[model samples]
Target: MPRLIYDYTKSELERVSLSPDRFRRKLKKAVSNLLPYEMELLQKWLVFYTDNRPELRQCISELQSDHKGVC
Candidate 1:
């Protein structure tokens, strides 16, 4: 069983590991479909997964500051 959020699996997320830009796009897509409660888990998972990948972390940091919510 894989970690899922709105039909997206953890592996789907993992596949974009090398490209932080793509990861940001995919994560934004995932976040769009999540309910309010699920957002927290998504954030936590984002933190855990992006740890040690500063570029990805920077992408995440950028995502957080996106008020317009555009990917």
Candidate 2:
């Protein structure tokens, strides 16, 4: 089964060592501070958090493009 939003976000928070509030701040910072490649990964992670397969697939496709000389 696919992961739920709660589980995904919880794991991400632990991985980054950030409190919920700080994670939110960092996510916002990423919007401006991250490079195109980094942003694509972030976007894919965010979409995965939603547990929406179609959207996640779309994000993955875009992320793949970033690896193919698009970024």
Candidate 3:
């Protein structure tokens, strides 16, 4: 089964009122139920959005700075 393991920490989810354990369980179930074609469609949309948008590339740099605590 495919999984959607989030990279965020437990403290991060707590800050957002999302229980990490519960979210992970739900994500596991959802991912297991997703069809292969659904995953392909998601990949297509991701490519389409990122490939066609220059602003998103800039956002990626901003996100990197935020990750490094320099934002």
Candidate 4:
């Protein structure tokens, strides 16, 4: 699953989202400043991220299965 809405690359995602905390911080910053298209992209990213990475969703969700968003 991609932690970012836009996949610059696998390496980029890995570099940016190195830790859960870091990922959340980045995600919050991003959400605070989103382009219109990016908002749409984020919706897609959420679907993919959650679908492909349940543990990631769980971790960010603090083990709440129904919770959403990274930050």
Best prediction by TM-score: 1
TM-score of 1: 0.76
Residue 44's lDDT in candidate 2: 60
Pairs that clash in candidate 3: none
1 or 2, greater by TM-score? 1
lDDT string for model 4 (1-61, tens) is 2335355432333465547665555555555555556646765665576566654555445
Sorting all predicted structures by TM-score, with the top scorer first, yields 1, 4, 2, 3
- What TM-score would each prediction reach against the true structure? 0.76, 0.37, 0.31, 0.49
Off by over 4 Å in 4: 1-14, 59-71
Taking the tens digit of each residue's C-alpha lDDT, what string does model 1 give over 1-71? 22355436356678987988788887777667676556666677778987888888987778778734332
Cα error, residue 13 of model 4, in Å, equals 4.4
Candidate no. 3 TM-score: 0.31
User: Which pairs in model 2 have colliding backbones?
Assistant: none
Each candidate: RMSD? 3.7, 10.6, 11.9, 6.4
Ranked by lDDT, the better of candidates 2 and 3 is 2
Q: Which of the predicted structures, 1 or 3, would earn the higher TM-score when compared with the native?
A: 1
lDDT of 2: 0.48
User: Which residue pairs overlap in candidate 1's backbone?
Assistant: none
Instruction: Give the top-scoring candidate (lDDT).
Output: 1
lDDT of each: 0.70, 0.48, 0.39, 0.51
At residue 46, give the lDDT of candidate 3: 31
Candidate 1, run of 10 with poorest lDDT: 1-10
